[model samples]
Target: MNNFFPAVLRLIAKLVILAIAVIAVAVIVFWTPGKPADELAERWATPPSLFMDLHGMQVHIRDEGPRNDPEPVILLHGTSASLHTWEGWAEHLAQHRRVIRMDLPGFGLTGPHPREDYHITAYSEFVIALADSLQIDKFVLAGNSLGGRIAWTTAAVAPERVTRLILVDPSGGYPLPPKSMPLAFHVAQLPVLGQLMDYMLPRFMVRNSLENVYANPDLVTDELVDLYYDMARREGNRQALRQRFQQDDNGHEQAIIRSLEQPTLILWGAQDRLIPVANGYEYARDVRNSELVVFPDLGHIPQEEDPDQSLQPVLNFLGLAEQR
Candidate 1:
């Protein structure tokens, strides 16, 4: 018994040391701040044409279209996505109505806000502040996936400001959870290993993510990979994305969707393994005077996947095109 006591004591000491090391590692990782968003923003550095201002933090947004256009549309992208998601749609829509798209804090070149929560309500406030800054009274709002969730919430809370609502595979409001959520979601859900992702993101990680969302892998060009990979390296962007994934707003937001009053158009990829097609129907039922359009071969992003087929339905809903 006396001999066994010495062995047990050695094991206890080893475990105590190991525990301290683990905690120390966690504290350092969590508290350590990251670099600025410049590296991430480099590939996206085009001819200077963005407006940056501190609305809590510096926001990067593109406001286009003729000043005289009455009905404007604000576009929002999904998780780990940037304002460029609407590049194709923006080129077309800006000609007709005022089109505004942005890199939401944490995801794109805009980076994360100083605020810790990054809640839906926090984002709702930022959008309103932007409208006030632009001196606009009311306009149409559209978003894909996570952005779509915010669009619905913004309309519900501030219906007076939102003229029309458009959603593409938006999360949070719909009952059906994402079918094959990104690998980041599972990692971000973990306690320890997930924290490592925010700090050290490989270029391949970005490539894998792009391929996963895209319906056709061949469509993901080297340039596209470079853009996404570089943008993710921006100082605060990765951490913001990490935290955004960790924050769960699922249960609290169904009531927000129920409160929506504005006319809405729900567009989805029928082959979307990310957020299932059931969400399109769920949103269509919730909003007043809503319509749902599902593309057979499209995945998560119908706008990017098949714009020619997708845009016609959207234009039809907005009454921008003459009825057939």
Candidate 2:
């Protein structure tokens, strides 16, 4: 035993030195700033359309509804997505009920804050704070993927504010990444490699990512591509995404969703490439009153790609089908 002790100590010292070198390199790479895309400036020239003071930062949101509408509805988008995910639903829902959608911190126009916490609880607090700023007390909550996880967490923490729950391909009960994925996701996970990739922001990379998300890649238009590219180039967004990916919540959301008893709607693209369709059933079985709606032949983003079919089910779930 004594003969081997010296060798073990030497190995430990070598490992420590290697770890320090790796960390030092990471720090240097992380500190360097990325050059913003040129055409991006033309597109994102304006400040966000809606900015509400929340947790010491300006939150960007889109609010729509008639003046007298009573039930306020909030929409949360998935990872790497902004309020645009709810564009079709918001446009239709705003007619009857007050609809509010925001870019969760680290995404879209709002980007990141001074504090870089992106855990579900942190996001939940921001959701409530946004609702407070808009004077919304009770509302239906709908979220997709990561957004779905945040919505459920908010309802579990503050049940009074969330009366109904809608989870479109929500992620928590399962542990599989959807087959169809966005490029931003992989790039954001690397410590400094992501920053370097962002600086190289190849237009083809953006197009390929958009192509992968939809069942029909042709759906990606020039103007819409510009929106995503421009917003991605905004100074703090890439860094914010990196910080958010590092945030962790100790799997408490699974138990909370299983105990959920709200009038819940679970919508999924049967062919969802990201987050998969099985996740829909996992939550359906957990939530006693949840209904699962699956759309065949669609990819990850059912709301954005197939709004006509997607909005109908969401409207029915909210009981706004007849009103609109």
Candidate with top TM-score is 1
lDDT of 1 by residue, 1-324 (tens): 879999999999999999989866765754434546554445474533374785666676888888776767889888778888888888777777788888887767788788766788878887888888887889888999888888888888898999888888788765666667666556666766567766655566577777777778778888888777666666777667768766756665666777787788889888898888887787787766788888888889878766677788778877777632
Residue 53 lDDT, candidate 2, scale 0-100 = 74
Query: Which ranges of candidate 1 are over 4 A from the true structure?
Result: 1-35, 39-42, 322-324
Residues 224-253 of candidate 2: C-alpha lDDT, one tens digit per residue: 786776666666887777777777553645
* Model 1 alpha-carbon miss at residue 302, Å: 1.6
Off by over 4 Å in 2: 1-48, 250-252
The 0-to-1 C-alpha lDDT of every candidate, in the order given, reads 0.76, 0.77
